[model samples]
Target: MAIQKNVLRVADLPQKKPTQFDIQPEAAQLDQITDQLELSALRKVRFKGVVAPIGQRDWELTAHLGATVVQPCVVTLAPVTTRIEEDISRLYLRELPEISEGSEIEMNTDDTVEALPATLNLDDILIEALALALPLYPKADDAALTQAAFTKPGEKAMTDDDARPFAGLASLRDKLNKDSDGSA
Candidate 1:
């Protein structure tokens, strides 16, 4: 879901150039995260964003960010440190109509602009960048070894169960198919 209120409006923020940002307290705890599923992870986040004005209703935001995501070993549940780096760009538009919700809305990509604000929220930009940095599946090397240890040596692999329980369906279908083919 979109972080509804968290995104700072372009008009509301200053149009100043992008600058480096370092968030404390919030970031300082990053190393403390050890796979607490029910809790927000601690993370050190750093990012830089540059805004280029396009037209009256648009701007191009380019950003790069880095974070350390404390993931767990898939097998042993040990804390695994994962480093992430991301480069993101977005075309910010004002007053987007619901009918044109598709990404077809044209934007001036050629670095043209009517104006920019003096400054903007750096946290929102970093949050967005970090969100993208989240990995689909995180695992540690030990986790792989743990799973490998669960298998039996030289054991036969089990077959996946067929979802349709009627094992005779294939034979019956073959008979019917033969009848139909013969008639044709």
Candidate 2:
């Protein structure tokens, strides 16, 4: 059976009770999440969490999320595998803070707090959290950028330092000083 994306209904949540959820995305769902995250590949994704009411209209949600992903190395373009684990927490409010056009909304930035919608979409949250946890630059353990051997048709290959414009500036300065001394 295909996994349902959104499962939690905030309205039906019992007062003073905590609800637990454990979700493991199937192959198809993992593919969808991988596409959404723009990852090279996703081997697995799992989330285990609990949601409990804290106040009359407020709730606290906490989850332990884990995922295995594959990304391209930034320098070598090789596939790099990564395992991600995160302890996620959020506070849901029944009433969202009002904001008008061109108005500033004040919010507490310390915690992941948001307005509670009619239903909570765990799939969406899982995708978002995984994307955030992914490394911006992934590189294989042994991948390193060696000196380039790129050269135009007949030109000699240039080393990395040779490609820099100022690499020979000190030598030029020394030759100029020697020439000046000889002329004197």
Candidate 3:
């Protein structure tokens, strides 16, 4: 079925049939998404999924998200392009456990469960999935950090070897043995 609107009311859905939906944002929408995500560019973003009723008063959303995105390299600032594909699932329950503000409580181990909302926003779901799938650090193929050394003029610089206390003691013992042998 053609999903004309981005938002759908949960109560209006068919009781026994699954609703298929596809989301392919326009150029302007893509630009907004790129700006929101801080991505250099986004192309060919698509979300295809089905929403079906579970047991009484529960619903499940299963979807596949695919997109091509470009991001700045973490080290060299070069553009790194990535193709992302993810399988997303969410369970909406009519009755969700409540948590008080500022209260320390054990988190539910199931991350896919959510309180049932009067309306489901597909755009929000797509954005959230994309954000979660993005790479924490992007790097170009030739990006590498070079080692640097610094020391004050006329002062000895501490190297990795000099940082070892045991190594310094061993060198001191060898020097003492050599001096004694020469004196004898």
lDDT of each residue in 1-184, candidate 3, tens digit only: 2223589799999989999999999988888889989999999999999999998798999999999999999998999999999999999999998889999999889989999999999988999999999999999999997655689999877787777879989989999999999999
Which window of 10 residues has the lowest lDDT sum in candidate 2? 1-10
Q: TM-score of every model?
A: 0.51, 0.75, 0.78
> What is candidate 2's TM-score against the reference?
0.75
**Candidate 3, after superposition: displacement of residue 108 in Å?**
2.2
Q: Using lDDT as the measure, what is the rank order of every candidate, best first?
A: 3, 2, 1
Overall local distance difference test of candidate 3: 0.92
Model 3 root-mean-square deviation: 5.2
Most TM-score-accurate candidate: 3
Poorly placed runs, candidate 3 (over 4 Å): 1-5, 98-106, 149-184
lDDT (C-alpha) at residue 158 in model 3:
75
2 or 3, greater by TM-score: 3
Off by more than 4 A, model 1: 1-9, 12-43, 97-121, 145-184
lDDT of 1 by residue, 46-98 (tens): 56566665655567777767666776555667776778888867655554435
Candidate with maximal lDDT: 3
The lDDT values for all models are: 0.54, 0.86, 0.92
Candidate 2 lDDT over 89-146, as tens digits, reads: 9889888677789977776576598888788888778877888899999999998877
